[model samples]
Target: MNFLSQDKSSSRPNKAIIILSLWVFAILLLGFTFRTSLDEMITVWINVEEYSHGFFIPVITVYFLWLRRHELKFIEEFKHSLPGLVIVFIGLILLILGGLATLKTVEQYAFIITLTGMFTIAFGLPGLRVGAIPLLFLIFMVPFPQFILNNLSSKLQLISSWLGVEFIRACNIMVYLEGNVIDLGIYKLQVVDACSGLRYLFPLASLSFLCAYLFKGPFWQKVLIFFSSAPLTIFMNSLRIGIIGIMVDNWGTEMAEGFLHDFEGWIIFLICMGLLFIEMWLFSRLSGRKVAFNELVLIPTEWSGDTKQGNPDIRFNKSVFLLMLLLIGAAIASHNIEGRKDLIPSRKAFLNFPLQLGKWEGRNDYLNQYYLDVLKLTDYVIINYTQPESGNHINFYSAYYQSQREGVSVHSPKSCIPGDGWQITQFGQRDFPDFKVDGNALIINRAIIQKGDSKQLVYYWFQQRGRTITNEYLVKWYLFYDSITMNRTDGSLIRLITSVKAGENIEAADQRLQAFIKDLIPVLPAYLPGKNS
Candidate 1:
């Protein structure tokens, strides 16, 4: 017995060294493989307030692993998995594609997948099942693509605004809701991105996930706890907005901006966390087991002493070593592949674009510094054109990007128009076979949008590599395809807006836009660089 104890103590240091060596190897490989993606994620965490919680996710994941260390120690059967190797291969493909397309989001997801594959290869299915939640939790750290974020933020803004106005009305306060704005007679509150409930939703969703994982309850109850995060965040945020509206009405507009507004957000987030605890308690009662909140949610101070010993001999799997070799080769290839620069087509700038288009006379317009910064456009042209004889006017806006691989790209009007208090009454595509541009027929997205009594007709399309795309999904697909095949991600968004006359029918507005598009298409090649340009 004395010899066994001494041998166990001596081998413990060897085990620790081996584990530390594996961890170091993992970190070094991941750093080399996902260098760009990791750097971009950290930059986002520092710069973007919505994603600030990202910095804590990995720490919490490590804590979770520590909490489960005893459970993991008991399962000592190490087996190399073919499925894991397949998954690693798939991850490598995704990484290469992500590198080729310059999509950081894809690279980040691929990194997680490859790590999961490594875990599977090291300890087989049992290890993966044990650490599944922690591995999955890493997803919260990845920043969502800009397009998805914009759409989600826009929708949250509208929903929160409506609910907030409803709450204010319940209090007998004279409040009106328009799109994402709350009108309280004296002051109006616009539910912008900051107050769109995202800040609360992301952090609370993460908290709820953690709570669900820690909660000792039925599977269904855990799922319910996790899924309740979205609705709770929306409700609490709406309540906060309503409270702000009441405060603004009674006191002043000062309650809605500056430090107080931010203070309200932090307070509301804490309240959201408290509400999650209340939910867990209620779930506990529903499960027919009355448990203290502390017992139900807190981490255990010490692990159970029921761990079983397994085979003393532990060796690194050959498959894992092979995987490392593959990773090294991929890292080298990806480094070379991503270093290739985008092919920028040579063309005249928007500065040289002609203002006069046949019968239409144009006056240039400029966006403010705030908008310019937000848009991140390489070049843009905003002009109002008038037909002198009929006194008809249309606002033409075009934004061009030299490279759309970065977060800055064309924002769909489908997302932006709604945020600006416009409601779409109708939306569809229009084709013009007779009016051709650069030997290809023209197609555009036509929409009738209204705010209050005023109505406007909008015509827009994505012009990329001489292709006229009406679908936003197609634009994204082509963006990816073109980036790989043609080495160009440059594109432009063209939008034309004209008011519908008081008595004019929709057809008349369509005709006006169609006539303008005919004149505009011929001159577009000079400004919007395409295959021909």
Candidate 2:
């Protein structure tokens, strides 16, 4: 009997080794296959401040898994699952589509799904149930797509600016709020993207998730702890802005720059963490339980109680083997498909675009080098056209990209205008029955934006592959659709802006843009690539 027990104990290590080996092989294979996606995620982690916390997510996930190792090992049996293979197949399909579209966001999500499928296949359902939270936590590593980030940042900037101004006003300081700029008598504070609270929000939210998971509390309390991060971050960020404003007012403008500014941001983030802890403590008190702070906040040492000691039965899952074969086949097919480049139609460069359109004469303008780098446009044109008779000048801007597969696509003016201190007060689509391009009526987004007392009439549309899209969501949909159907993701944004002068009716501004659009319609195909071109 002693000899039999010794033999069983010896087999346990062998089982562990086999399981570890399979996991390592699967992970290494996934890493090799999704190398580009991983590189892109790492690039964002290193460069983008808001998502820098992504660097620690993988380590945290592994730590969580390690903590649950005992529980996973005690499972009664490991069985091959058909459902796991089905999930793996779906993940491979997503990988193939994401690869063909060159969408890093899609590919990154697919990588997570594929990893989950592998885990489910290797560990079986019971093991997965034990480690589910850690697997789900991996999602925090992926940075949001640029469009969503832009919109969120813009909204946060506006909210922080408003709250900061109100706080200053309560302190008896004379302050004026215009969009995202706080105008204080001698100095102005612009709530740029960095101050939008996202830098604090993402990391703090991740921390809150960790805190919620570890907090030994009721379900409702855990949820409350997780949801509180947003408001806490926003409030703390606004408080920081108000403090900066007060310091600048008393100590001069130097208080708002360099080390002091960044130090304040760090301080605010720390305060947010403290607030979350305070929330957890409050919940503990309300629940009629006195839990120690260390117990509530520390990493869990154990996931589950130990089970009977025995050598659990284990077998190689043929379904997982078949799934691996399918993955290998899909990887080869994706590599070949991605290697083929899309067809780029020839078109006239923006430089050769006509400077004179009917009665209007134009002078070209150039964007700053920093702006050009940020935009990453393949080609662009910016011109101020004036009707010499009416002295009505309109700014015409167009940005063209040869391909948008790599995520550098057109940014909507709706997302960008507020960043420059302009607030969009009115927005809707306008149809020009008289204006025709290739026998189709013109439709464009018309927005009335204001800054201080100044107003401007803006018209913009996305021209892509013979489609004129006024809606931003439709543009995104078409980008995905065209990437799959036509193997083309080339597009351009055309914007026309005219100021509403003092005491001048907005109708005049509208008419001015309409007239310019009429003149600009026929000539756009020369520069913007379309089906006819």
Candidate 3:
């Protein structure tokens, strides 16, 4: 009887150790499975200023876990859950789909999903309840997709420029605002992508969320605290621009350049963070209440480690075996996926494109080296076509990508048009049933954009595989679908721009573009490959 009891007593710690080892193995397997995405995210942290905060997010997450360690006491037992298994399967599907699509954003999100699913599988609802915040907080490290970043940067530039102009005007300084450019008589301040405040917003938003998690206050106050980061960053960033303008007007452009300019960003971020704390204090005092910094932070009570070690009832659950197998399978599958190369289709070079098409006489134009480096297009053609009869001219441009993976893909005209000091007055898609490409009716995105007294009519569409895409989001979907089903991700952006004469209406410009498209359509197939090509 005594020998049997000793054997059973020795087995308890062995069971616990096996469970701990399996947990560690599962985590390592996840890291191996998602290594590509993790590497990509780390690269963004190192290279991209906007996402530099990615490096610290993991550390912060660990701190949050430590803060909530005492709550793990509630996790007395873990059992097999069918719902969790379903989630795990869904996560696995997403990982495969994302891999097949060659989408880093999707893969990054899959990491979060799989982690959630596995956590549930291992510990069930009780553990998830305690650890949800820390786990979800890791999302801040994943960078936004390039298209979203571009769209957001463009919008923020305009907002910052407009508000900065307002601040300058309030100071009784002469200023003119056009798109994202601020004109101050002798000085012109262009609010480039770097000045878009994303560098500040991303980090501040992450910090705000963490602060909200720790804030000991009403739920509404915590919600307000988390949501305030964006406006706070934008308003302060704009103020910094305004201050730079003021300094420039008085101290010349030197104040807005070199080390001091970079220093200003850090200063603005600190000020914004300080303001958040002040807001918290003001909220605490609003209803005749007071809370100190220490009080504001909800600290989890730490107990002696006796409960953790003293409990002999804890035993390893068998769900971990399934988790182990799933993770290993995921790792092996991802390895094969990472090795797959994009399929590049054959097409005529853009340089071989004819200069003369129908009645329009085209003169080929070449972009500067800087633009070529920035665009990263595999092949492209740009030409200004003119009709000698009416002396009317139209700008025709098409950019093609042999593989739309990584950062190389179509740049939507909507995102770039406003960056060049144009305000889009009317932007929507129109069906040109009268116009056809390969007997298929064409649907194009038409826009009326203006800069000062100058106005232009622009039409654009994405030619993906064999389909014409109008919406930017839809293009992404097709990119993924085609990459998987058709083994093709090649696409092109075809755009036509024509001036809307001072006295003429939009119809006249439309007529000009109509003529150009009629001639251009016949020429596009040779360069932009379709399914048949």
How many residue pairs in model 2 have overlapping backbones?
Answer: 0
Task: Judging by TM-score, tell me the better candidate of 1 and 2.
Answer: 2
- Give the clashing residue pairs of candidate 1, or none: none
Candidate 1, 228-304: lDDT as tens digits: 99999999999999999999998999999899999999999999888899999998998898998778787655533
- Position 17, candidate 1: lDDT: 72
Measured with C-alpha atoms, the lDDT of residue 318 in candidate 1 is 54
Q: What is the lDDT of candidate 2?
A: 0.84
- The residue pairs in collision within model 3 are none
TM-scores for every candidate against the unseen true structure: 0.92, 0.93, 0.94
Task: Order the candidate numbers by TM-score, best to worst.
Answer: 3, 2, 1
lDDT at residue 230 of model 1 (Cα atoms): 97
Error of 3 at 222 (Å): 1.8
Regions of model 1 farther than 4 Å from truth: 1-23, 73-79, 298-314, 437-440
Model 3 C-alpha lDDT per residue in residues 404-448, reported as the tens digit of each score: 986778988888888767889998888878776656688999999
Model 1: C-alpha RMSD to truth?
3.1
Q: What pairs collide in candidate 2?
A: none
